[model samples]
Target: MAAVRKSTNWFAIGVTAAVLVVVLIVAGVVWFANSQATSPGTLPESSAVNTETGAIAVGSGDKTVDTYIDFMCPVCNQFEQAYGPTLDQLVASDEITLNIHPISILDRASQGTEYSTRSASAAYCVAVDDAANVPAFVKALYAQQPSENTAGLDDATLASVAASVGASDAATSCISDGTYTRFVTAMTQNTPVQPGSGGIATPTIAVNGTVLSNQTDLTGDPQKDIVDRLNG
Candidate 1:
Protein backbone atom coordinates (compact mmCIF):
# COMPACT_ATOMS: atom_id res chain seq x y z
CA MET A 1 0.00 0.00 0.00
CA ALA A 2 2.89 2.43 0.81
CA ALA A 3 4.59 1.68 -2.53
CA VAL A 4 1.34 2.26 -4.42
CA ARG A 5 0.82 5.66 -2.70
CA LYS A 6 4.36 6.79 -3.56
CA SER A 7 3.85 5.80 -7.22
CA THR A 8 0.58 7.73 -7.43
CA ASN A 9 2.24 10.88 -5.97
CA TRP A 10 5.08 10.68 -8.54
CA PHE A 11 2.55 10.38 -11.37
CA ALA A 12 0.68 13.43 -10.18
CA ILE A 13 3.89 15.50 -10.04
CA GLY A 14 4.80 14.51 -13.62
CA VAL A 15 1.35 15.46 -14.88
CA THR A 16 1.51 18.86 -13.15
CA ALA A 17 4.91 19.56 -14.71
CA ALA A 18 3.59 18.75 -18.22
CA VAL A 19 0.58 20.99 -17.73
CA LEU A 20 2.80 23.90 -16.65
CA VAL A 21 4.98 23.44 -19.72
CA VAL A 22 1.95 23.53 -22.00
CA VAL A 23 0.69 26.69 -20.32
CA LEU A 24 4.06 28.42 -20.75
CA ILE A 25 4.13 27.50 -24.43
CA VAL A 26 0.65 28.92 -24.97
CA ALA A 27 1.54 32.15 -23.17
CA GLY A 28 4.65 32.61 -25.28
CA VAL A 29 2.70 32.12 -28.50
CA VAL A 30 0.08 34.64 -27.44
CA TRP A 31 2.70 37.23 -26.58
CA PHE A 32 4.44 36.77 -29.91
CA ALA A 33 1.21 37.10 -31.89
CA ASN A 34 0.24 40.26 -30.04
CA SER A 35 3.60 41.83 -30.72
CA GLN A 36 3.29 41.08 -34.41
CA ALA A 37 -0.12 42.74 -34.53
CA THR A 38 1.03 45.94 -32.82
CA SER A 39 2.91 48.79 -34.45
CA PRO A 40 6.62 49.35 -33.92
CA GLY A 41 6.07 52.70 -32.13
CA THR A 42 6.27 56.30 -33.41
CA LEU A 43 7.42 57.07 -36.93
CA PRO A 44 10.46 59.13 -37.91
CA GLU A 45 10.05 62.91 -38.13
CA SER A 46 10.58 63.09 -41.87
CA SER A 47 7.78 60.61 -42.51
CA ALA A 48 5.49 61.52 -39.65
CA VAL A 49 1.96 62.65 -40.45
CA ASN A 50 -1.66 61.88 -39.69
CA THR A 51 -1.61 58.49 -41.38
CA GLU A 52 -5.37 58.59 -41.74
CA THR A 53 -5.71 61.46 -44.19
CA GLY A 54 -2.34 63.14 -44.70
CA ALA A 55 -0.09 63.27 -47.76
CA ILE A 56 3.48 64.04 -48.72
CA ALA A 57 3.59 67.29 -50.66
CA VAL A 58 5.94 67.45 -53.60
CA GLY A 59 6.46 70.66 -55.62
CA SER A 60 4.61 73.88 -54.85
CA GLY A 61 2.16 74.93 -57.48
CA ASP A 62 -1.17 76.68 -57.46
CA LYS A 63 -2.77 73.51 -58.76
CA THR A 64 -2.80 70.44 -56.54
CA VAL A 65 -2.76 66.92 -58.04
CA ASP A 66 -3.28 64.25 -55.41
CA THR A 67 -2.06 60.78 -56.43
CA TYR A 68 -2.75 57.75 -54.27
CA ILE A 69 -0.61 54.70 -55.04
CA ASP A 70 0.20 51.28 -53.63
CA PHE A 71 3.50 49.58 -54.39
CA MET A 72 1.94 46.16 -54.79
CA CYS A 73 -0.80 47.28 -57.11
CA PRO A 74 -0.15 46.46 -60.75
CA VAL A 75 -2.49 49.14 -61.93
CA CYS A 76 -0.70 51.73 -59.82
CA ASN A 77 2.58 50.68 -61.36
CA GLN A 78 1.10 51.00 -64.83
CA PHE A 79 -0.30 54.41 -64.03
CA GLU A 80 3.06 55.54 -62.71
CA GLN A 81 4.87 54.27 -65.75
CA ALA A 82 2.38 55.93 -68.05
CA TYR A 83 2.02 59.31 -66.38
CA GLY A 84 5.18 59.51 -64.31
CA PRO A 85 7.26 61.50 -66.77
CA THR A 86 4.44 63.92 -67.48
CA LEU A 87 3.79 64.43 -63.79
CA ASP A 88 7.47 65.02 -63.11
CA GLN A 89 7.63 67.61 -65.86
CA LEU A 90 4.56 69.36 -64.48
CA VAL A 91 6.03 69.45 -61.00
CA ALA A 92 9.40 70.70 -62.29
CA SER A 93 7.76 73.46 -64.30
CA ASP A 94 5.64 74.43 -61.29
CA GLU A 95 2.46 73.79 -63.21
CA ILE A 96 1.09 71.43 -60.56
CA THR A 97 1.99 70.48 -57.04
CA LEU A 98 1.99 66.69 -56.85
CA ASN A 99 0.63 65.35 -53.58
CA ILE A 100 1.89 61.78 -53.54
CA HIS A 101 0.09 59.65 -50.99
CA PRO A 102 1.84 56.30 -50.60
CA ILE A 103 -0.68 53.94 -49.08
CA SER A 104 -0.74 50.16 -48.45
CA ILE A 105 -3.86 48.37 -49.57
CA LEU A 106 -2.51 45.18 -51.11
CA ASP A 107 -0.60 43.67 -48.23
CA ARG A 108 -2.64 40.52 -48.64
CA ALA A 109 -1.19 39.97 -52.10
CA SER A 110 2.38 39.59 -50.88
CA GLN A 111 2.22 36.03 -49.58
CA GLY A 112 1.99 37.22 -45.99
CA THR A 113 5.22 39.27 -46.33
CA GLU A 114 3.26 42.55 -46.23
CA TYR A 115 5.19 43.90 -49.21
CA SER A 116 2.77 46.72 -49.78
CA THR A 117 3.25 48.12 -46.29
CA ARG A 118 6.98 47.44 -46.34
CA SER A 119 7.48 49.22 -49.63
CA ALA A 120 5.32 52.16 -48.63
CA SER A 121 7.22 52.44 -45.35
CA ALA A 122 10.52 52.39 -47.24
CA ALA A 123 9.24 55.19 -49.48
CA TYR A 124 8.43 57.26 -46.40
CA CYS A 125 11.98 56.68 -45.17
CA VAL A 126 13.26 58.10 -48.42
CA ALA A 127 10.79 60.98 -48.28
CA VAL A 128 12.16 61.98 -44.87
CA ASP A 129 15.84 61.11 -45.26
CA ASP A 130 16.31 62.18 -48.87
CA ALA A 131 13.46 64.45 -49.73
CA ALA A 132 14.89 65.35 -53.09
CA ASN A 133 15.18 61.70 -54.06
CA VAL A 134 11.57 60.80 -53.34
CA PRO A 135 10.61 60.79 -56.99
CA ALA A 136 13.63 58.79 -57.99
CA PHE A 137 13.06 56.30 -55.19
CA VAL A 138 9.42 55.97 -56.13
CA LYS A 139 10.26 55.40 -59.76
CA ALA A 140 12.84 52.80 -58.83
CA LEU A 141 10.41 50.94 -56.60
CA TYR A 142 7.70 50.79 -59.23
CA ALA A 143 10.15 49.92 -61.93
CA GLN A 144 11.02 46.80 -60.01
CA GLN A 145 7.66 46.13 -58.47
CA PRO A 146 7.24 42.50 -57.56
CA SER A 147 4.37 40.31 -58.67
CA GLU A 148 1.59 39.45 -56.25
CA ASN A 149 1.70 36.27 -54.10
CA THR A 150 5.49 36.39 -53.94
CA ALA A 151 7.79 37.15 -51.03
CA GLY A 152 8.52 40.53 -52.66
CA LEU A 153 11.81 42.30 -52.27
CA ASP A 154 13.66 41.72 -49.05
CA ASP A 155 14.85 44.61 -46.85
CA ALA A 156 18.35 44.37 -48.31
CA THR A 157 16.95 44.65 -51.81
CA LEU A 158 14.84 47.63 -50.86
CA ALA A 159 17.84 49.34 -49.23
CA SER A 160 19.89 48.69 -52.34
CA VAL A 161 17.18 50.23 -54.50
CA ALA A 162 17.09 53.31 -52.29
CA ALA A 163 20.85 53.65 -52.55
CA SER A 164 20.60 53.46 -56.33
CA VAL A 165 18.17 56.37 -56.22
CA GLY A 166 20.56 58.53 -54.13
CA ALA A 167 18.98 57.82 -50.75
CA SER A 168 21.49 58.26 -47.95
CA ASP A 169 22.60 55.47 -45.60
CA ALA A 170 20.09 56.62 -43.01
CA ALA A 171 17.33 55.57 -45.37
CA THR A 172 18.69 52.04 -45.30
CA SER A 173 18.24 51.75 -41.55
CA CYS A 174 14.73 53.19 -41.77
CA ILE A 175 13.77 50.69 -44.46
CA SER A 176 15.32 47.75 -42.61
CA ASP A 177 13.58 48.66 -39.39
CA GLY A 178 10.22 49.17 -41.17
CA THR A 179 9.87 52.45 -39.33
CA TYR A 180 6.76 53.58 -41.17
CA THR A 181 4.98 50.22 -41.41
CA ARG A 182 2.45 51.28 -38.81
CA PHE A 183 1.88 54.52 -40.62
CA VAL A 184 1.23 52.68 -43.85
CA THR A 185 -1.06 50.30 -42.03
CA ALA A 186 -2.99 53.21 -40.57
CA MET A 187 -3.23 54.96 -43.91
CA THR A 188 -4.56 51.81 -45.55
CA GLN A 189 -7.10 51.25 -42.84
CA ASN A 190 -8.32 54.85 -42.72
CA THR A 191 -8.43 55.83 -46.37
CA PRO A 192 -10.86 58.66 -46.89
CA VAL A 193 -13.86 58.36 -49.16
CA GLN A 194 -13.73 60.50 -52.25
CA PRO A 195 -16.72 62.09 -53.91
CA GLY A 196 -18.16 59.96 -56.76
CA SER A 197 -15.50 57.30 -56.28
CA GLY A 198 -17.33 55.49 -53.46
CA GLY A 199 -14.35 53.93 -51.60
CA ILE A 200 -10.66 54.78 -51.97
CA ALA A 201 -8.70 52.84 -54.58
CA THR A 202 -5.08 52.63 -55.61
CA PRO A 203 -3.87 54.85 -58.43
CA THR A 204 -6.70 57.23 -57.60
CA ILE A 205 -5.83 60.60 -59.07
CA ALA A 206 -7.58 63.74 -57.96
CA VAL A 207 -6.97 67.20 -59.36
CA ASN A 208 -7.70 69.95 -56.83
CA GLY A 209 -10.01 67.62 -54.85
CA THR A 210 -11.88 66.44 -57.94
CA VAL A 211 -11.17 62.77 -58.51
CA LEU A 212 -10.56 62.02 -62.17
CA SER A 213 -13.26 59.88 -63.69
CA ASN A 214 -11.06 58.54 -66.46
CA GLN A 215 -7.49 57.42 -65.85
CA THR A 216 -6.63 57.12 -69.56
CA ASP A 217 -7.44 60.77 -70.25
CA LEU A 218 -3.76 61.80 -70.02
CA THR A 219 -2.57 59.55 -72.89
CA GLY A 220 1.09 59.88 -71.75
CA ASP A 221 1.49 63.12 -73.68
CA PRO A 222 2.55 65.82 -71.22
CA GLN A 223 2.50 68.71 -73.72
CA LYS A 224 -0.85 67.73 -75.21
CA ASP A 225 -3.54 65.68 -73.43
CA ILE A 226 -2.00 65.82 -69.94
CA VAL A 227 -1.48 69.56 -70.08
CA ASP A 228 -4.93 70.09 -71.52
CA ARG A 229 -6.52 68.09 -68.71
CA LEU A 230 -4.48 69.85 -66.05
CA ASN A 231 -5.24 73.28 -67.47
CA GLY A 232 -8.90 72.45 -67.95
Candidate 2:
Protein backbone atom coordinates (compact mmCIF):
# COMPACT_ATOMS: atom_id res chain seq x y z
CA MET A 1 0.00 0.00 0.00
CA ALA A 2 2.85 2.42 0.83
CA ALA A 3 4.58 1.66 -2.50
CA VAL A 4 1.33 2.29 -4.40
CA ARG A 5 0.85 5.63 -2.63
CA LYS A 6 4.41 6.73 -3.49
CA SER A 7 3.89 5.71 -7.12
CA THR A 8 0.67 7.76 -7.32
CA ASN A 9 2.41 10.82 -5.88
CA TRP A 10 5.23 10.52 -8.45
CA PHE A 11 2.66 10.18 -11.25
CA ALA A 12 0.89 13.38 -10.06
CA ILE A 13 4.21 15.29 -10.03
CA GLY A 14 5.02 14.14 -13.58
CA VAL A 15 1.60 15.21 -14.81
CA THR A 16 2.02 18.65 -13.21
CA ALA A 17 5.43 19.04 -14.82
CA ALA A 18 3.98 18.09 -18.19
CA VAL A 19 1.23 20.69 -17.81
CA LEU A 20 3.77 23.36 -16.93
CA VAL A 21 5.81 22.50 -20.01
CA VAL A 22 2.75 22.84 -22.18
CA VAL A 23 1.89 26.17 -20.59
CA LEU A 24 5.40 27.44 -21.20
CA ILE A 25 5.24 26.39 -24.83
CA VAL A 26 1.96 28.22 -25.29
CA ALA A 27 3.35 31.35 -23.71
CA GLY A 28 6.39 31.26 -25.98
CA VAL A 29 4.19 30.90 -29.05
CA VAL A 30 2.08 33.88 -28.02
CA TRP A 31 5.18 35.98 -27.46
CA PHE A 32 6.58 35.03 -30.88
CA ALA A 33 3.34 35.87 -32.63
CA ASN A 34 3.21 39.28 -30.98
CA SER A 35 6.81 40.00 -31.88
CA GLN A 36 6.36 38.98 -35.50
CA ALA A 37 3.21 41.09 -35.70
CA THR A 38 5.25 44.17 -34.84
CA SER A 39 8.40 43.17 -36.68
CA PRO A 40 9.58 44.90 -39.91
CA GLY A 41 8.97 41.95 -42.15
CA THR A 42 10.40 43.39 -45.39
CA LEU A 43 11.80 46.63 -46.68
CA PRO A 44 10.12 48.34 -49.62
CA GLU A 45 12.13 48.40 -52.85
CA SER A 46 11.95 51.50 -55.04
CA SER A 47 14.08 54.38 -56.26
CA ALA A 48 11.69 56.75 -54.52
CA VAL A 49 11.82 54.81 -51.25
CA ASN A 50 14.51 55.40 -48.66
CA THR A 51 14.62 52.26 -46.53
CA GLU A 52 17.25 53.65 -44.19
CA THR A 53 15.07 56.60 -43.26
CA GLY A 54 11.77 54.82 -44.00
CA ALA A 55 10.54 57.67 -46.19
CA ILE A 56 9.11 57.96 -49.68
CA ALA A 57 11.25 60.61 -51.27
CA VAL A 58 9.45 63.01 -53.55
CA GLY A 59 11.83 65.84 -54.46
CA SER A 60 15.55 66.27 -54.99
CA GLY A 61 16.02 69.53 -53.14
CA ASP A 62 19.02 70.42 -50.98
CA LYS A 63 17.22 70.75 -47.62
CA THR A 64 15.29 67.75 -46.33
CA VAL A 65 11.71 67.94 -45.04
CA ASP A 66 10.34 64.83 -43.42
CA THR A 67 6.72 64.40 -42.41
CA TYR A 68 5.74 61.40 -40.34
CA ILE A 69 2.07 60.74 -40.88
CA ASP A 70 -0.54 58.17 -39.92
CA PHE A 71 -3.39 57.97 -42.47
CA MET A 72 -5.99 57.36 -39.74
CA CYS A 73 -4.92 60.40 -37.71
CA PRO A 74 -7.36 63.32 -38.02
CA VAL A 75 -4.71 65.74 -36.92
CA CYS A 76 -2.60 64.47 -39.79
CA ASN A 77 -5.40 65.16 -42.25
CA GLN A 78 -5.75 68.64 -40.79
CA PHE A 79 -2.05 69.18 -41.18
CA GLU A 80 -2.26 68.05 -44.78
CA GLN A 81 -5.15 70.37 -45.50
CA ALA A 82 -3.33 73.30 -43.92
CA TYR A 83 0.13 72.84 -45.36
CA GLY A 84 -0.20 70.56 -48.37
CA PRO A 85 0.02 73.44 -50.79
CA THR A 86 3.00 74.99 -49.05
CA LEU A 87 4.84 71.69 -49.08
CA ASP A 88 3.96 71.16 -52.71
CA GLN A 89 5.26 74.60 -53.58
CA LEU A 90 8.46 73.93 -51.74
CA VAL A 91 8.90 70.62 -53.54
CA ALA A 92 8.12 72.13 -56.93
CA SER A 93 10.59 74.94 -56.40
CA ASP A 94 13.27 72.50 -55.22
CA GLU A 95 13.56 74.25 -51.88
CA ILE A 96 13.22 71.13 -49.76
CA THR A 97 13.23 67.40 -50.35
CA LEU A 98 9.94 66.04 -49.15
CA ASN A 99 10.31 62.66 -47.48
CA ILE A 100 6.86 61.37 -46.73
CA HIS A 101 6.95 58.62 -44.15
CA PRO A 102 3.67 56.70 -44.24
CA ILE A 103 3.53 55.25 -40.77
CA SER A 104 0.84 53.44 -38.67
CA ILE A 105 0.40 54.49 -35.06
CA LEU A 106 -3.39 54.77 -34.98
CA ASP A 107 -4.29 51.16 -35.67
CA ARG A 108 -6.23 51.14 -32.42
CA ALA A 109 -8.58 53.79 -33.85
CA SER A 110 -9.57 51.65 -36.85
CA GLN A 111 -11.98 49.18 -35.21
CA GLY A 112 -9.65 46.21 -35.85
CA THR A 113 -9.53 46.85 -39.59
CA GLU A 114 -6.09 48.40 -38.99
CA TYR A 115 -6.84 51.21 -41.45
CA SER A 116 -3.71 53.08 -40.58
CA THR A 117 -1.49 50.16 -41.45
CA ARG A 118 -3.49 49.22 -44.51
CA SER A 119 -3.51 52.72 -45.96
CA ALA A 120 0.15 53.29 -45.29
CA SER A 121 0.90 49.94 -46.87
CA ALA A 122 -1.18 50.92 -49.84
CA ALA A 123 0.84 54.09 -50.13
CA TYR A 124 3.92 51.94 -50.41
CA CYS A 125 2.22 49.94 -53.12
CA VAL A 126 1.64 53.14 -55.05
CA ALA A 127 5.17 54.19 -54.37
CA VAL A 128 6.42 50.92 -55.77
CA ASP A 129 4.26 50.93 -58.88
CA ASP A 130 4.03 54.63 -59.63
CA ALA A 131 6.20 56.86 -57.50
CA ALA A 132 5.09 60.07 -59.15
CA ASN A 133 1.45 59.53 -58.20
CA VAL A 134 2.35 59.22 -54.50
CA PRO A 135 1.61 62.86 -53.63
CA ALA A 136 -1.74 62.78 -55.39
CA PHE A 137 -2.59 59.51 -53.68
CA VAL A 138 -1.70 60.98 -50.31
CA LYS A 139 -3.95 63.97 -50.91
CA ALA A 140 -6.77 61.73 -52.06
CA LEU A 141 -6.43 59.57 -48.94
CA TYR A 142 -6.88 62.60 -46.70
CA ALA A 143 -9.73 63.81 -48.88
CA GLN A 144 -11.66 60.64 -48.10
CA GLN A 145 -10.29 60.13 -44.64
CA PRO A 146 -12.62 58.05 -42.48
CA SER A 147 -13.76 58.80 -38.96
CA GLU A 148 -12.17 57.21 -35.95
CA ASN A 149 -13.37 53.78 -34.68
CA THR A 150 -14.85 53.12 -38.10
CA ALA A 151 -13.71 50.24 -40.29
CA GLY A 152 -12.34 52.93 -42.61
CA LEU A 153 -12.06 52.34 -46.37
CA ASP A 154 -12.26 48.79 -47.58
CA ASP A 155 -9.43 47.33 -49.70
CA ALA A 156 -11.40 47.87 -52.91
CA THR A 157 -12.02 51.52 -52.11
CA LEU A 158 -8.36 51.97 -51.37
CA ALA A 159 -7.60 50.45 -54.76
CA SER A 160 -10.06 52.80 -56.40
CA VAL A 161 -8.47 55.73 -54.67
CA ALA A 162 -5.15 54.63 -56.10
CA ALA A 163 -6.67 54.19 -59.52
CA SER A 164 -8.24 57.64 -59.34
CA VAL A 165 -4.75 58.98 -58.75
CA GLY A 166 -3.56 56.97 -61.83
CA ALA A 167 -1.86 54.20 -59.89
CA SER A 168 -1.32 51.15 -62.08
CA ASP A 169 -2.88 47.68 -61.88
CA ALA A 170 0.06 46.31 -59.88
CA ALA A 171 -0.40 49.07 -57.33
CA THR A 172 -4.03 48.03 -56.84
CA SER A 173 -2.94 44.44 -56.39
CA CYS A 174 -0.40 45.47 -53.77
CA ILE A 175 -3.00 47.46 -51.86
CA SER A 176 -5.36 44.49 -51.81
CA ASP A 177 -2.65 42.18 -50.52
CA GLY A 178 -1.32 44.57 -47.84
CA THR A 179 2.27 43.83 -48.82
CA TYR A 180 3.92 46.51 -46.71
CA THR A 181 1.83 46.39 -43.56
CA ARG A 182 4.67 44.96 -41.49
CA PHE A 183 6.93 47.60 -42.96
CA VAL A 184 4.49 50.28 -41.79
CA THR A 185 4.42 48.70 -38.33
CA ALA A 186 8.20 48.78 -38.18
CA MET A 187 8.32 52.42 -39.34
CA THR A 188 5.69 53.38 -36.76
CA GLN A 189 7.78 51.78 -34.04
CA ASN A 190 10.81 53.75 -35.24
CA THR A 191 8.95 57.06 -35.66
CA PRO A 192 10.99 59.98 -34.36
CA VAL A 193 10.06 61.06 -30.85
CA GLN A 194 9.24 64.73 -30.97
CA PRO A 195 10.51 67.25 -28.45
CA GLY A 196 8.49 67.51 -25.17
CA SER A 197 6.10 64.75 -26.25
CA GLY A 198 8.35 61.83 -25.22
CA GLY A 199 6.18 59.72 -27.56
CA ILE A 200 5.33 59.29 -31.20
CA ALA A 201 2.90 61.69 -32.86
CA THR A 202 1.57 61.97 -36.40
CA PRO A 203 2.27 64.93 -38.66
CA THR A 204 5.53 65.31 -36.82
CA ILE A 205 7.54 67.48 -39.14
CA ALA A 206 11.31 67.64 -39.22
CA VAL A 207 13.22 70.31 -41.09
CA ASN A 208 16.79 69.56 -42.07
CA GLY A 209 16.66 66.65 -39.57
CA THR A 210 15.57 68.80 -36.60
CA VAL A 211 12.17 68.03 -35.13
CA LEU A 212 10.03 71.16 -34.98
CA SER A 213 8.25 72.24 -31.83
CA ASN A 214 4.67 73.45 -31.95
CA GLN A 215 5.36 76.11 -29.35
CA THR A 216 8.65 77.57 -30.58
CA ASP A 217 8.69 76.72 -34.28
CA LEU A 218 5.05 76.73 -35.31
CA THR A 219 3.56 79.89 -33.85
CA GLY A 220 -0.01 79.77 -35.34
CA ASP A 221 1.24 80.05 -38.94
CA PRO A 222 2.54 76.65 -39.97
CA GLN A 223 3.20 77.72 -43.54
CA LYS A 224 5.37 80.66 -42.55
CA ASP A 225 6.97 78.57 -39.87
CA ILE A 226 8.02 75.88 -42.33
CA VAL A 227 9.17 78.39 -44.91
CA ASP A 228 11.17 80.31 -42.34
CA ARG A 229 12.67 77.08 -41.05
CA LEU A 230 13.75 76.10 -44.57
CA ASN A 231 15.24 79.53 -45.21
CA GLY A 232 16.69 79.68 -41.68
lDDT of 2 by residue, 1-232 (tens): 5565433588889999999999999999999999998778777899999876679999889998899998889988888878888889989998888999999888898889999999999999999988899999999999999999999999999999999999999988888888999888778776788789888788788998999865466564655778887787
> Residue by residue across 41-69, what tens digits does model 1's lDDT show?
55546543334454777788888787888
* TM values, all candidates: 0.74, 0.83
Q: Which candidate leads in TM-score? A: 2
Clashing pairs in 2: none
Candidate 1: where are CA atoms >4 Å away? 1-41, 47-52, 194-197, 214-226
* Alpha-carbon lDDT of model 1: 0.79
lDDT (Cα, 0-100) at 213 in candidate 1: 47
lDDT (Cα, 0-100) at 132 in candidate 2: 95
Looking at model 2, report the run of 10 residues with the lowest lDDT sum.
Answer: 1-10
lDDT of model 1 at position 231 = 78
